[model samples]
Target chain A: MSQSLDTRSSPGATPGEGPDATRQASPAWRRLARLALRQREVSIFLAGVLLVLYFQFSNSAFLSTDNLANLVQFSATTAIIAAGEVFVLVSGELDLSVGMVYALTPFVMFFAAGAGLPVGLAVIVGLLAAGAVGLVNGVVTTVLGLPAFVTTLGTLFLVNGLTLTISGGFPVQPTASGTFTSLFGASPLAELGWAVLLALVLQFVLNKTRWGLHTIGTGGNPVGAAEVGIKVRLIKTGNFVLCAALGGFAGVLDAFRIGSIDPLAGGNDIMFAAMAAAVIGGTLLTGGSGTVIGALLGAAVLGILKDGFTLLGVSAYTFDMILGAAILVTMAINVRLSIWRDQGEG
Target chain B: MADASTGRELLRAEHIAKNYGQVTALTDINLRIDRGEVLGLLGDNGAGKSTLMKIFTGFVKPSSGQLHFDGKPVELSSVSHARSLGIEAVYQDLALINELNVYRNMFLQREPVKGRFLGILDDKKMRAAAIEQLDRMGVRIPSVDVPVAKLSGGQRQGIAVARSVYQKARLLLLDEPTAAMGAKESALILDVIQRLKDEGEMGIIIIAHNYAQIFDVCDRVNLVEGGRIVFDKKTSETSVEELTDMVVREYREARRSVQAG
Candidate 1:
């Protein structure tokens, strides 16, 4: 880094003046490449890729087309949920109710479908129920001036209780509607469900929209955002709504993919893993800086790691411990890197 | 026509008073700012300078008295109301989002949208306008895309100034704009204030503790003690030594009164 800086600052470095000028002109591209390489998401992605390569060399079944497809299929739900978590995390807030909301969504759909409602409308209604819960959580946090963690925690338990009561502690197996089940549960096309499509669209919106910019700004500096007339409250509210809506959609996808709606379908472990993926991907808990792509990459890394560990004959309990430790170590490294970067710039 | 001859007072605060429960923050404060003049508000710490400025910027409401804008009595309910009437403030912190690039920060609240349908932020136009405004003020930043956090302190201040001016602020209130700045940056800011004065169409109220700065940039200086205007004099008619004496005298008298009570 020091060498590059020195070269950029050397004499006769003016654009179009000398050989150094050519290098100076390419600084923007070089800087972009450096940024991509330095991104925490990229590092996690490389780790996932390396893990996959190692597993494939060790076990022939690991690289089989069927296993690879199954891996992607398994990761799809986690990726969708983590994508939603990214918005909440970036806005300097958290949603603990997401796991409960995820569990409740499938129940809502199954009941709606049983009550003579069409599969599509039932799914929509289920999503709306999740969104409504999210809205309640957001209003509770913002209007009541409660900490998001506390507010969402209350909602988490409330939703979980409601789901258990509705299901009567029993799993419901809906007669899979041919079109709906095929769209979200089948082989090749299942990979392209509403959850995955929504994730892609959300990633785009988070990067390319005015709303995204304001969310980042509000998280980074709410006071500054308010002073500049960015309407921090509105931005935060929108982020909450987006997160809830996505979490609800992920819940619907889970119902279709799993072919059954269980009371404990989306347990605490799913929420924990989603959050871990987001943090490991580079979304700081303190907020202000993060990317949706980073969350997806983090999800991919975790999924690959889990799959690779299983292939390598690692015990399930040991794998869980290792995953938890890896998340902690990655988070610590991220913080150290951020501090070093800030100090170097200063 | 008569109002035009009188230059139509832009801002007037009459008998303004503020209190925080049992504590009196300001008392019987009366002031007026006219178009194209710099009103230097000078006060020591705890002298209600910040209180008055907050009321002016609609950050706080006075417990008593009325604020009038453009010769009409009005209540500024929020900062947006103040901004809509061309009142812009540059607080001590500058209130700029440091993570954003210069163009985005400058037009944060008022970004120009482009295209006919599905309009997106007109980055090209905003960048051009930002560069033009900064260049006009002799501010030279390396790139408009650089986040403000990476910029120098002086450069950040310059961006704040540029933002206020770009918004076509008619009444600019700068609260200790030079307090934390070095001599050169402060001088640059002072030059910008002077240039705004030369434009002769906007009113400026600068709050500063430094007598030298007030003297250098202000047309008239209003000295406040105990939330009341103890002295208001033309900068040309007053000496720095006399202003210092008045401030010291005001402080001592307040202290003596407290001691007596």
Candidate 2:
């Protein structure tokens, strides 16, 4: 028995010095490289850096202050929505109605303000309306035992129709002004600040809370999570609510930044981009694990490509082809990298 | 090292029976385990060993039964209810989230929280505690930071057992602790079980197929057949040959009845 224990320590010996005397004599730099490859967010962050360099080399205007700010602001919307999408994806669910909710929120706020409510209160009403859609999505998906994809798909159309009805299918200037608009999204870099802050906070929540741990466990193995007394339904429902609310908030921010709330804004286009950012950020499409910071970096990559392409006189129509190819390649790389890591360790 | 000594009664099942609609999974089971004792449950496939274990772990409720814990009558309404009373089971599946790190899985639903913050998990503290517990049990691993999916079968089983022990479970139920394991791995598990028995702090009920292993670590054995315990005896009073013969006779009778029907 003692002999078995003595031999068992050799298989999983790490590089750094430890109590296990049977540790393998691997070089420090090699181990460091292995660690970087093991962490998905680290690899994606590197990829984002590479994309920045590629864009800067292709188009000098890509690094200008004006273009840089524009890049951050444009990607801010995708980053915020992707951050929320991480929680839902990690909890083994999907929120397809986020794009529709994004288009619907500002309209809801505009209608509320027109009805004699204060702009601040109207914004709250907008958020509440957004949260209500999320609640309906959560309840219908969980309580009725419907798949979240189907449930959110139904709400997506419903919300799109509602936004069109409320806005009379026309783009309208937002009534919000002063501190409300500035704090929300009107000022330079305001949306960027919100995006970064929300990503950091959500990343901390994912790493340092029971809520995050349970979320991972629920998605990784629902039966195991339930066996350990975790309320799987509640965790999943909460994630759905979070994803939709973030989607709605992003929509409101976009409206404030662009100075207009269009009924047709943020349809399936933005929805697919946010989803792509999450997947490119190393979040598994099948769920179980994700990273918020990775999602932000992923959004940065997309933003760089879009802005860089426009500066280089590349047509807008070509961007979609690149986006589709990027998604496929990123996912394939993620799978292949993980398999290699496993083989190296084993 | 086996001796004749009476320990405090820890758990008792009285008239326990379970039925899945018209299918009788378990019928009229009466059993008891004492603190500092290792009781082995021997059974063929579909003979109600797992059903009985599920009832004990609060995963399944018997149609008719009364469970007595610590000499007091109690009702286990859920897995958490059983765990709150210090009754934990290491199931056949191990009930582990493979994507989670070893420390996280060890603290699964009951994560240690930082005192300053309301809902923040203290990963450092959990890692330290996991190291301590695994060290105490002589279960060696590379690190607590690695995910359980990256571990061997024996190491994963060790983590499950170590988690149950770390939670201070007074009654530990192990379902097939050594199934599918190689000889070396089984020896390691049996060694841990023997060490736990020597510590004399927990009442353990182990379900195993190997008679040799049962004799090696268990103080008593119960042979479950047709959803009922047909043979109950002290391990010291029986031989592997005797138990094997009994099972063979029962199998022959079952086969004859099947042919006739």
Candidate 3:
């Protein structure tokens, strides 16, 4: 252990300088750099790079501007959802209703638009409907002290039932009006503009705000955070609400992208995909540590794999099996990298 | 040893009692901690050491008791209330997020922010402050940027100690700070405790099962048994053997009573 500590020490100390003196005099900058790279994220990032290169090699189409644009567009939808899931995960909670919430958002927007509601009002109402579901989820979880998984699972069914009951179990199509379609799902900039913008904003909030710190703290150690005067319950409740809103927003984006709202827009498969993206990006299911950028990268990796496989004419049925395998492998690699990093530090 | 005559008492607990459902967890516990003194709370598992500390830190409201902080009667209704009054508890778990680096963990919930509205976390200021705080505590690590999950148990504990000190915690409650540490690492932690004592009149309540450690750094030792204080004596006035005997005797008596019932 002493030998390892010595090896890990900063390079400025003279060769014969005593260990105690070396420890006492080491510079702070060197230490900070060491801390930044000594985690699973760095390793996962490297793996993501390797995957990108391998896919690019296998298919000449992989690196084309058009494919890259499509890849970003595809990832934008899932990345937005995952960004919110990051909050829920960081608060040591989960929202299984996100998938159902995603399915219900478009219907709310469609009905609002059909009622002659202004686009802005319709958007607000749609967001509010999602926020309300999130609020209920948060209240039930925090006030009643129920585990987030069970509460959100119940909400999943509840939201799904509501969507079915409202839509009469049928798909809802928007008027295809230029303004309505453009705001909801139009790609005027020739890419997923709103989706990308939302992802970036969420990323900024996660990385730069007080809410981000509290979310991380709540997930990392609830008891410790509480002792430090952090309102763990409040942070967690806020995360659930935020996550629901994001999921709902993603649903709106999806509806606009497709120009229609299916009763099963984002079914269980998308939830699995989002989870895979998050976990593969280094967000542990156990919570306390995650990054929006990592999730975005993870989503990109998945998007590339799926798109590439489909472009190569791989069967859709086989894609599921491939995705399942990919998720398992990525998660296994992430776990191993974390363990290795931990061992290296000690 | 310095004279105990100068500093004022910072915390006092009177007839503190707590019950969990039907079972009594702690009973009639009385203790006093003066500024700049380290008081060791010693007991084996299930000896109500944790319960006493919990009550002091407001994790569990005492069914009945009076807790006085800074000579004022205070009701610690929540952990935040206790912390706002300069009380901070460092549990054995260290409660650090493995994914966050030292500065982030140190300033976790109470991050220093800049600006009027949507004040951003002052990362530069926080990082500098975390370095200063840990350095003052005599803790040397590779970096503050690495996630704490990568740190050794000793390093992690050091971060926790640094956090409490950074918060200007007047009364620090450490629950087995060095329980799983090696001899060298444990000694390093003891050095931190000594530094804290000299730097400020920060009263500390250290809960530990290790008698040697407790005896080495503590000014006084309080032995708890069967949810009550069985012996409270100055460390210099008491021998380790006597302390061991008191613990063993309490254990046997408690076991006998349980068997008899």
The TM-scores, one per candidate, come to 0.89, 0.92, 0.85
Judge candidate 1 at residue A4 and give its lDDT: 45
What are the DockQ scores of the candidates, in order? Answer: 0.47, 0.63, 0.46
Q: Which stretches of candidate 2 lie over 4 Å from their true place?
A: A1-33, B1-7, B115-117
Clashes of each: 0, 0, 5
Least accurate 10 contiguous residues by lDDT in model 3 chain A: A7-16
* TM-score of chain A for the candidates in order shown: 0.86, 0.89, 0.83
Candidate 2 global lDDT:
0.85
Chain A TM-score of model 2 versus the true structure? 0.89
lDDT of candidate 2 over A183-281, digit per residue (tens) = 788775788899999999999888789888898998899888888789999998888888888988999888888889999999888888888888888
Give the TM-score of candidate 1 (chain A).
0.86
Between candidates 1 and 3, name the one with more favorable TM-score.
1
> How many times do residue backbones clash in model 2?
0
Per-residue lDDT over A8-68 for candidate 1, one digit per residue giving the tens place of the 0 to 100 score: 2432233225334434345553453346435656666656776787788988899888777
What value does the lDDT take at residue A55 in candidate 1? 84
lDDT of 1 by residue, B1-261 (tens): 766645557888999999999999898998988899999999888889999988988889999999989888989898888889999998878878766789988987677765544335678888999999998877778899888888877788888988998899999998887887788878777888888889888999999888786587898999877889888988899889999888778778888999999
- Segments in model 1 whose C-alpha atoms lie over 4 Å from true places: A1-40, A192-196, B1-5, B114-119, B254-261
Q: What's the CA error at residue A174 for candidate 2, in Å? A: 1.1
Best by TM-score: 2
Which 10 residues in a row give candidate 2 chain A its minimum summed lDDT?
Answer: A14-23
